[model samples]
Target: MGLLFILLLGVAIHWASAAKLGVVQTEGGQVKGKNVKVSLLFRSVDVFKGVPFADVPGMWEKPKPHPGWDGVMRADTYRDRCLQVTLLQKKTRGSEDCLYLNIFVPQGRKLSTNLPVMVYLYGGAFLLGASNDMSFLGVSLYDGKEMADRGGVIVVTVNYRVGPLGFLSSGDARLPGNYALWDQHAAISWVRRNIAGFGGNPDNITLFGQSAGAASVSFQMLSPHSKGLFRRAISQGGVALSPWALQKNPMALTKKIAMKVGCWRMNEDVMIKCLKMSDPVKLTMAGKIDVLLILGKGTVMDLIEFSPVIDGDFIPDEPSKLFHNAAEFDFMAGVNSMDGHIFAGVDVPSINSKTANTTVKSVRGLLAGLTKEKGGAAVESAFSVYSSNWGSHPDPAVIKKTVADIETDFLFLVPTQIALQLHANNASGARTFSYLFSMKTRIPGFPSWVQAEHAEELQYLFGKPFSMPLIYFPRHRDLSKYMIAYWTNFARTGDPSIGESSVPAVWPAFTENRRVYLDINHKISKTSVSSDLRSYYVSYWTETYSLLPSTRQTGVLRAGDLSPPRGRPESSARET
Candidate 1:
């Protein structure tokens, strides 16, 4: 009788555990996720991996809502990643039919309070990345399990198209660009319509991304199609104003790819058809070859090869003009301290200030490769400003630092500041926040001086396992909690600091007048924006004139108008 009683108790406990980690009914059908043990604090969380967000009928076409299954779908493991070259410069296992998303719901949440949704878009310069592939960056960046469990929010990771298959344009309507952005839009729409069933508040969704993904967030804010899908946004280390975010001459690059793939001789329609039929591997290889050629030339083209174009439907106008008409919602945008390291090649040679003329010449050569004929004057003016800032001939370290500064401002900082300013200026009580991630990380093989390289904050925010000893980097673990708090809190409410966790400092809203940004280090603090840097670079980019094609001939500054700023109005500009 005692043995039978003990057996019955054990069976009851097993059934109770099963009920806690059981199936959920989504809009399409029922899904059974795996019971995952996420870290120490939050033991068991149900993670639905590789859930199809959209249906891919073919390559180079817009994605549609997924035709979900009839019966229960087992979502235990991640699906295939979208095809792209890996960080190691080798091809990995992926497919063109890859428009899936991962949904993670925290366990033990009360039924009354529905959790907010946070969608993550990974970044690889629009060339490579995956939602579930640990070979990419998840081991030390973007762990969804920890984010969902600890933050008490539904975290989603999405996979979208990239490379030539995603951004090919033919100057006409035969093959338009921005198919990748369209994929993102579809994914967001899916989340909005179906996330409620997964214990998420679809109305209170936040879109957050880094690098190329960050640029996409900025673009979505500007585009009319994505309005009202998500309530808040966070762009890290990239923005629409960044030179690499928008492709200058998409057709020219498309032609180069076609020529390499032996489809150049065909008519526009035939060429596109041939491209569709061609091997995905060949297309990816061709793109990589051309990109290497562009990078090897030591030109500004090193930053990007293929990216979102100004398609009339999706990205109707110049990014600056579109920023004025963006949806009124809370925004948080920022960059890392060492973001320039992304643009500066791995083997960046120290620029010796002793060779002032050589330094100027090299800089000119790099800028000249990326601009149009009319843009020469802009490049020359930019050179003059940099030379003045560096004081003709200074120390080698000074030259190196100045170069990194210019790269940072041109690629990330200036653009990010301008975006924040625009969002703040055109406000309908929707607050704007800016931050600078300056925490020093100890990623293996990198120098100790490395202060948060691009996307380093992702590791802490998503709870990647530690690369270094926790004893040595205890503050980073603490910081991870703080960042997740800020992000998930912002998703729940508009303000990040008004969330669940205890933050180290009070984060203030960004105002154009005060120009205050939260500096997130070991100890967070609100500090003054860089007056000299902002005045020099941001003013030049935002206040002077736009580089985009203008609708009004008189309002747009011509190439001849780029004169010296001291005696005249505005003269200098930066590069890609």
Candidate 2:
């Protein structure tokens, strides 16, 4: 009996030794990860969850490298997510000890292996999001394992601070904001130093994200702080050029929170100290943040409150001006068909119930005020360009649809186009590609016209339909495969079509003269290769609005003054 037990213990020790890593260990210690078999690909991948990549700094301070520790930290489970408010701010979950990141490496790799690495950042309007096993209908929305297996690369999903804890700034030396940006920067630095331990090629890293995460990828590309951390970038449905990407008044939320917590003092430094000592849960729900764009007549636009601001150190200047180094990056960006449903549905609520043209009346008044500022011709030209031409007594549903289209054009479509053009021009043939995801995948219960809403393409890219086959249609599986291939290919090589995997259609590069983009819609088909989508409207925004007294340096163009207004979305962007 003793001999049999000794033999079993020796075999267990042998298997453990085989899995042990070399000199590339986390700051805390060595991590013990599990080998998860990806059923769809019939392959297994090594996953290390809750790895402490950095030790986040205090209340409003920047993050630093994690101090080394004594022994193995056991990274098999997800650590606490950064403290955040959820369930309508009625309750809160997560903790300040939440600077952990999850790493996924493809199986059959060794110390000598040199695979490409992709770091993912989640988007919650910079208010709320997590990198820990996000799922709906049994689909892991942001699983890095699926990408690792499909792309044959190493994948990293990082957790950065959000909301007041992450972005509160006084626009001064006392309380500089952008702690979240520092968190992301530190994570990338950690990858550059430590990813080689897992057989990852640190020199060939790709940064990709959706919405605010996509905006962060843009920041990472443009900011001098992230100069040599990454070489490639992809932004989907969002970019730093979007009006909501930068904060107008970084100090407003700080004041509100200080008042609620009874920490309101004359000095900013004193306020920071009080905030650090308060209960984190109370801190989460304390402040009532009134977001951006108060137009003429005190009309507030729909925009997120907690986003990065110009601390003059991290951001340095306006987003548009920072693209001078664009030639160094291989860039890809695009938008969804109805990305603005999140804004319009709230701005024009329950079309049938609010049938008295209540929403329309408010919008018209808002337009009149805006035209008053710019000119009467502004409203005239806007209506001329976007005239639905619906006869009297038009369906309220149609009115809501029009609002959605208007929002989509201003917020998602045009901003993405301007950004694509900027990168393509500056890249000087370094391979920039753009695409529009128009897959007829509308949110359930939303109006039929609201097709391909924002963040819908993410699931397909993350391989949700493949994992939950019974819940989706066959077309979904096909699209998911194509997206995974294209994305991983971009991460591996500078070009999307030059890799081991095969994609359905060859994705073309975007250039100034070509003005090309790939339209990815499997259900309702369009020409695979297209050019300058909606040129007339694009011209309307780029030409007419460029004349307005807007500052790209500040990134503060109100949707109403620049175009048309339909801005509220905190109650709406989350439903879908």
Candidate 3:
């Protein structure tokens, strides 16, 4: 009788263990996950589902009363991506309730081990992206079992509101603008609260993003609300302090959007009610009507109008001003070699009298607003230098390219360099490392002329070149290993160059004097490709401008306006 009782008890225990470690069904499908054998916590594979982060009471304005998940969500499949205004026909289905996140971990892992956590923010010009995109699927990025065997880490990808819904600012108290930024905060909070259930260490989170996502990471660093949420950050292309990036001025832009959507005439309460009653698809379409107008306008515009707000609650001040004052955290920021060339078009000659005058006035206004103190002479000197440098170029195309390059550097690279310099100078013990991705890939339809274009490093970092049409070379795996190791190592320790595990080259530290950059090419070396250009930009920016509040200044002459003079500038047009 005693022997029989012992056998029965052992069998019951084994069955209970197996049942505890069974699979959990999610909205998309079933994923095998585990439940703690000793502890009562359930480490399920799919824990989060499509959860709304904010409530858009009205269609034309910012969100209100952020929303939270009501129950344990089954996050087996990716939620539908946000609604996009597609020029090309593509399947699209998602709700405004699409602020969602996904967590991936080893099939069966214990929570006792505090694994490093990587929270990914996707990139689509802060307008389009989702956690469910195949490109963002992290299982292949970090092989769970392999990582666990070596050293465990958790990967979390989150989706935030985008486009008009997230960025359109009303600059009104009724509309707390930058709802998308709010969504990101909510997602981070969720990770802090629930990532532990998946064997992730919330305390050691590494925030990383590419392109617009990278810019978002920089924004988080500046945000007081995001303090302590992440220990480390990596920005691929987008840096927060760029002159051309978005600034938060919600009221004006939100009012414009409201007017465009036919709700501007109504009171706030009435507008909100009308927007809520309208069809979501109609609102989405109406929102996209201003894409062309807002194309060149980036986060820098937000500095004056609407992007990420400087609300006392979320963001306190401009990231540039903030970083310049003091460094609160560590960062890894960089830009691609040919970032400007990818988006470049055929160049044009000097602007005509009308265009030139408009351009001058616009430039003057921007400089005046940025530099609240009188610095007109300095601004003119800077412009004269730019004009002379541009004029010296023999080829009109080359001159245009240089202008575009300046714009790109001003809006992206310079800000990144500033942030790195600030962090290196101010941070207590934390270090700042910088790199320039110059490795050009040989992919079909990759415009052989444009080498190492914008967002090119994404393939190498992700260890998969899906966007690349074809892989002609065999060194892809080598590059992938090198990049992944460097990135993962950074995530492990705040330093990216802690050790040379599997990477081929030795990445050096970025110092004020040395100014070393990891030149990623066939033979990755530390060198400066455009020292002259870099020097010119640094000098011009430093010598010019005053820091002041940004304001609305329109009628700026853009490159797009300079189409070849109609009918050779002398022919009369036919009446319609």
User: Which of the numbered candidates is closest to the native, going by highest TM-score?
Assistant: 2
| Model 1: per-residue Cα lDDT over 196-279, one tens digit each | 777888898889999899999898888888777888889999988777788867877887888889888547677777877888
Residue 564 lDDT, candidate 2, scale 0-100: 20
**Which tens-of-lDDT digit does each residue in 1-576 have in candidate 3?**
999998788656544433232343333234343332221222223233344334533443434544433344444456666665453313334666566565655333332346677778887666566765544334333222222222235667777777666665544455555667777776777677656655567887888887778878888877777767878888887777654346434555655656767776557667755655666665555555343442333223332233466665556655555653335456788877656444332111121122321234444433343333334564565456545533443444334334445445555655666666656666665656777776764544533334566677766665453223154355665565566667777777766656334555566666544444565554543342222225445444533332211243321111221121122111100000
Measured with C-alpha atoms, the lDDT of residue 185 in candidate 2 is 89
Which candidate would rank higher by lDDT, 2 or 3? 2
What TM-score, computed on C-alpha atoms, does each candidate reach? 0.85, 0.85, 0.70
Q: How accurate is candidate 2 locally (lDDT)?
A: 0.73
- lDDT by residue (127-158, candidate 2, tens digit) is 78888646686535787777787778888998
By TM-score, the better pick of 1 and 3 is 1
**Model 2 RMSD vs true structure:** 6.6
**Model 2: CA > 4 A from native:** 1-24, 40-42, 109-112, 137-139, 266-279, 288-303, 351-381, 388-398, 523-526, 549-576
The lDDT of each candidate is 0.70, 0.73, 0.53
Ranking by TM-score: 2, 1, 3
Better of 1 and 2 by lDDT: 2
lDDT of 3: 0.53
